[model samples]
Target chain A: MQFGLSDSQLLLKDNARKFFASECPMASVRRLMETGTAYDAALWSKMAEQGYLGIIFPEEYDGAGLGKVDLIVLMEEAGRALLPGPFFSTVALAGAVLSEAATPEQKKRYLAPLCRGEARATVAFLETGASWNPADVRVASANGRLSGEKLFVTDAAAADFLLVVAREGVYVVQTKAAGVSIELMNGLDLTRPQYAVRLSGTPAEQLGNSEGLARGLQVGAAALAAELVGGMQRTLEMTVEYAKTRKQFGKPIGIFQAVQHQCADMYLETESARSAAYYAAWALEENSPDAEAAVSIAKLYASDAGRTVGNRGIQVHGGMGFTWENDVHLYYRRAKASETMLGDATFHRERLARLVIDAHGALAKSA
Target chain B: MDLNLSADERSFRNEFRTWLEANVPRDWPEWREKPLEESFDYLRAWQRKLYEGGWAAVSWPREYGGRSATLMQQAIFWEEMARLEAPPMANALGLGLIGPTIIAYGTEAQKKRFVPKILSAEEIWCQGFSEPNAGSDLASLQTEARLDGGHYVVNGQKVWTSYGWIGDWCELVVRTDPNVPKHKGLTVLLLNMKSPGVEVRPLRQMTGESEFNELFFRDVRVPVDNVLGQVNDGWNVAISTLMHERGSYGARLHLLFKRNINRLIELSRTFKHNGCPAAQNPLVRQKLAQCYAEIEIMRLNQLRAFSRITATGIPGPEGSIQKLFWSELNQRVQQVAQELLGPYGQLAKGDLLAVDNGIWSYGYLRTRGNTIEAGTSEVQRNIIGHFVLGLPRSY
Candidate 1:
């Protein structure tokens, strides 16, 4: 079986890299972080114009009728640029949930605006502790009314609507609806802000089923894995360049075996994470039986690799890496934040173990 | 990016599976016994049977009496073989290493003399590269091969020679020009194991098995025609042999790990911890799950490397990445299995009360070599550093 990306896919990736580099440089990320803006409206519009926001949406809904794999390619570039926005929240999470679980009328009303960049939305799944367990959902929905709080809801303050995960099912609640309170919280990753939203008897529409919730998570997690890979790839490139130019003693520090090994280890981590991420993206796109397992595997590896490689990126830069003036800390913060989001490495590992046990049944010997 | 096998490949796998079911003996040897000669003979006979069935050397080209399977089919063959928990071919070194090298660099006469015999298991092969002093830095090996009259008088020693005692031929690497640099002075000779001055002493490992041996050559005489490649180019030939040795074998090793983990999962269900099934223990379950993920990653990484090989004729330094990951992952898996076994883990293979006949215990000990052989973890990291990462050489 062929595993390499198609020629068109490769061309899209190259174009995305150039676009991100030229359009949304790290300076824009720093600017958004410093100004306390939820995101750059101009850049969001530019991205919508680039057809990235609708990369995975069907063309019938004013979108680019591409696959999830293509969306991942763009997401990777966004991550490399550290593009500050709710692109992941809107496209990968809420967008996926709507298309997968919503009725035709609901799609026309909800997903169409999201596809056309007329509205921003996000999925508010977890209530409190950073647990991704389905059983951890505590938001209650009954009789077309919603009352609960969603903690660490990403980009909620900037979104037009929120897909709230509730005990009964998912409810599409408007952010500005009465009896709703949205509080912005300072997060470890300044590039992507988090919010705490409280809803009290807010009127909402039922998505009818959580049919695609798992699919949504898989798509989201795979997208995030690609982002982590992009971040790590840049970290490695920066670390390598720094090592070659930065001299210590009589030669470049890269010549030192210890530093060289650290760089080598980072390279290994980044490449492995990329491989896992790519496979997960492809599997999720194809809806393969192994997609869920592949997502966990990719997320598990990328979560750990992101943190380790990012920390090593800073470590190799020595004192400069510790400073806010240096850009390495930006990726390090993003890495730490992303490592626990959706699910941590340990959490994914436990999920994977359960899957193995379930699949083996009597062969597993453990209930 | 389709990961599923194509129709042709699937059919090839089915045919191979049916053949195996029809031909493979139901009762196989559980473990090797003392004096090993009978078991070794049985193994050779099995290899011959496979060769006669045209299933041996599936990865080799058709001109060499092989099926010329594509990389994917070769991978499928190994995967199915490991799935059946099939015994390794008796002439693994010949089939995996020497045969490929000979095809790449041997003379017409050399190919005619050795190729078919290797496939038929009439002549088993072993490698003679690593010396006591030249382990990681193989080019520093001081084995001497002086041209005397019409023969080369070889006097050197090779350690960690798998199947040395039983092999009919040794792919020997020696220095023919002592005055030149370490890498340039070497030569490769197909040494007859029955030579007058040859000696083989088995080395006992931590697993209590003498699966490997040390070879001592005291002026073993070899005809000049025995050289496989050009004189003083043995270094390149040795590298070629190593590339073949490391390539695509990961698929087979991955299957073996998958099978062992399946067994461990079964054991976890049967075993108890804190008065409940051990599989119910969150910690043990997490450990097992971690093993499963790592093993899957090992397999996926091999597929990625396979893709690279398909794109480029050669496997690039990415082999070092998979090499480092899988070797370490294999050990971690066995460690998890041993931990799951609890008190039963300490039992030896033949102990009366041992679980799975103490296979886990033996496996735990045997995996110690997983990191050390082929290439040490340190050496792999070095390769990644210098070759893959373009870092300055530590040496």
Candidate 2:
């Protein structure tokens, strides 16, 4: 009945923290975000060397066989470092779906290259409607050719392949294939660049069923929640540090009850989000009965908490927090973007309502 | 990372479940329907039955008449109690706060004298720490005790004393030295409620319940041997009791929130809203789902706290976090209840058309004190700020 990380998981977390602190610090993140791709190939390969690219894939696919919990541990560290690139889109989103849906042949062909960092992939889930629901997918594929647009496709510009969600099923499309074009979007979170991918009769291969895609979305939501937890945590630390040093009214602003309580509220939100995120990751790993509900809960709570902690973080920093020169705004931007990426709090809350109402409705009927 | 119970824990849970299924009073809910004062005998008897069944104080050491259960087993015990809707133990303060303090700081003689009675509900205990002047600033309390012969002559008053009216013993903190610092001059004494010049006046809360009282002590004498710890270190002793209150109440509170939420869900199905069942309303569903998520988070947060305690033999500042979250969350839940039930929610108990015997209304009022009692939300935030976040203490 323990709710703590295992010895190996703790080691993984510590090593990930140290790795990000050294390899992908805020300076490096800033440097990369200014670039068009907002990505560093060398950093990608280094993470691959560290086995993070395959942290959740099975060993049969030449990957490190770890669970969703382990993936979250890495994702959280990446989030703290604000590690700019396609790590989330490549590994957490696309990799999760591929691992869940791919056959041995498909996995060996696509997943192995991803594990080795030879290729990067991103999931093209949201359509013009900007809904995460698979049922909202309007892009149709006929005879393994897709012709439609996928919106808010994260890291699509940096990806070698795209997992396009179409009306038929999830399709794997080569990003450089004929009739496929990627245009970078004006994303608020510059750290993780997004792109609009337009596929016109693009040759593709069907990867998996909608059920598998749905399950993978849950994993993605949980993973994003973990990332949000990390962002919230770092924001809290930054806010607390700023409060301790930023003097106002002849004393550190932290000495004032107003500022102190705000910081405390940040701590509360961050910690609560962490609990939700970690539990979601564990539930998915264990195939717990509440895994679906837990994932939505995590995403819902983290989506709200991330924005809140960011707001408080900026508020504590006063003028400095509002400027691009300071790193606090970067976290704030990422929080806002991430809040809507998987499913915003409102979206997840409605999803949760469906789950709860349906379950209770069934129970009432059976009784 | 593993949340599944081990074989031993499962067996222990099963054993307790069996006992509870067989022994739990069938008419316990009926007893609860009576006034709080009238229900004491039933509650006390229930605790005694648990003691006789070897289920009382499962987390305490075996030498102290407990089963010496592991933390997981203790958690399972609470979970099962909630599952079965078992009556609450009459000596909750004795078992949860005073008894643990006695075990931590009591002499061997004190343990032998108090521990058994606490488990058996032979004696009920109340905390006498907060005074009128020392609600949040407890160190500023003026409850004074002067050493007289073989006893301490205590004076001054303690307000908001839970279970005071029926308490057999009082864990009283008094200022033993006025010359020293306010925090340094205090002492904790085990005072008999029957002592001369002691008074307990019922304090009616907004819920119309006299669950708490104002305790006045005009030279009430407490024996020297009744002092729980050192004479001038009552501050530390009281802190320990408060920590216990904050840290260990999570599991029980989780069950309570769970029960209330389930009831709310059931009512939402029957209650009308905008020409439909409230459960069918999109807004109400969102509110209920949010409450459900928070309640699940509460349970998970409790596990995290338990994990920390298991890893490190002391409760960390996470207790303050849980306290702050749950108190505010309860208020939110009650507010949602009002929104869902409308005017009927405001009906008092025994009202002809009151929903669920007006429990939602009672809860709506009772939960108002959750944030204010134990510690105010402001005080909790201060604790989290100073202790958890390393923020400078507010002046």
| Model 2 regions lying over 4 Å from their true place | A208-210, A359-367
Candidate 2 C-alpha lDDT tens digits along A1-367: 7898888999999999999999888889999999978889999899999999988888888789998888888889888888898999988899888988777789899999999999999999888888887778899988889999998989998999999888888899999999999998998999988899999999999984445877888899999999988898898899899999989889999999999899999988887888899999998989887888899899999999999899889988999998989998898888899999888988887888776665453223211
For residues B1-395, could you state the per-residue lDDT of candidate 1 as single tens digits? Answer: 66778899999999999988788865564534333655777778889989999988998899998898878888889887766756678899999889989999999999999999999999999999999999989999988999999999999899999989889999999999999999999999999999999999998888888889999999999999999899999999999998876675677788878878877887777788888888888889888877877787787778877877887777687667877888888889988987888888989767999987777888888889988998787888888777877767768
lDDT tens digits by residue: candidate 2, B204-299: 888887889999999788889999899899999999999889877977899989888878887887789978999888899889889989999998
Question: What TM-score should be assigned to candidate 1?
Answer: 0.96
User: Chain A: TM-score in each candidate?
Assistant: 0.96, 0.97
lDDT, candidate 2, at A240: 92
Candidate 2 chain B least-lDDT 10 residues? B27-36
Candidate 1 collision pairs? A365-B269, A366-B269
Q: What's model 1's lDDT at A339? A: 91
